[model samples]
Target: MSERPGLDIKLPNGRHIQYRGIRYHGSPQHIFWFEFLPTLLDHTIREELKKTAELAKSTSVSVEQSVAEVVALLNNLVQRAYIRAVDVDRSLMGDGFTKGEARDVAHNVEGYNKYIVEQSNVYVLEYSSNEEKVNYAIVQEDVLDIKPNFCGIGININALWRKIKGKFLP
Candidate 1:
């Protein structure tokens, strides 16, 4: 007998089939950039990065490293808050999901992160899913203007905040 654990009745050839296994790849994840937060809301992120850097015990911590850790925390926080605010099952994203069937269940920093929504100020978010622990990201943080051009457009922060709050909360 083979090491496999399922019933091996090979008598039925075509109509019936058996799935040996299903692999959940934690590395080299498929990333999707759904949307981005404009520089308007990035003030808090800058302060957060400084705080992250200050908390590091090692003096050799670089800005890139600090930004990565904080961005991961923000995304995780948003996802969790949303899940708690409304039951994931109630949300239309997925009507319902079983343990293994839920594809977006990821909080491990060591896991490959695919859905990256970075605060434009930090502009650097990195993830290492496997043994290859290397930072190979090139972001254009230093532009000639040193600020994002909103294309001469104006915004009301108060109204924006209300819309954002309503979308995420309730």
Candidate 2:
């Protein structure tokens, strides 16, 4: 009689949930955790934008004005990411590029951040699943790294809060 190969599976209870000669519970959830890090960063940016807009509004600023201000703030937040330089078309000229144009470029920051987070979440979910099909250990490690990055983004957002408070208060 031929001997079957041993399987290695991870259970939800922090134990190896094994299946027919393989790990069954080792799904993309492990990988999804790592992918969650960037999504969290994007979420922090969104929260900062919203908070800044709220502060602007409370100070008697119009919604449009607040949006513009938030956009500028967001530009600073992700300066390292070079998001604005990459996505914004500085070459475009005309009414759209005017200083007081209704469609201010800064106002698009929130939308851009939202789109990035949504797309990243979708991709992470799919990628995690694929990783599970291959190897769960890799995905788990990736998620562990993301946790620290997410925390860093949160700290950045906190600093943004302080700046907004200082700017609008008194």
- For all candidates in order, the CA lDDT equals 0.39, 0.44
Q: Which residue segments of model 1 deviate by more than 4 Å?
A: 1-47, 55-58, 87-120, 123-170
lDDT of 1 by residue, 1-170 (tens): 67665322222122222333433222111111111111212334455655664554245455456656777776665555434423432332333453323333334322212323333233433222222123333223222222233877666565566679989988
lDDT of 2 by residue, 57-169 (tens): 46754434445555555545654333433332232222355422122334345555665445433333333334332463443343323222464553445445557988998
Best by lDDT: 2
lDDT of 2 at 56: 48
For each candidate, what TM-score against the reference? 0.28, 0.28
Clashing pairs in 1: none
Candidate 2 residues lying further than 4 Å off, grouped into runs, are 1-34, 79-170
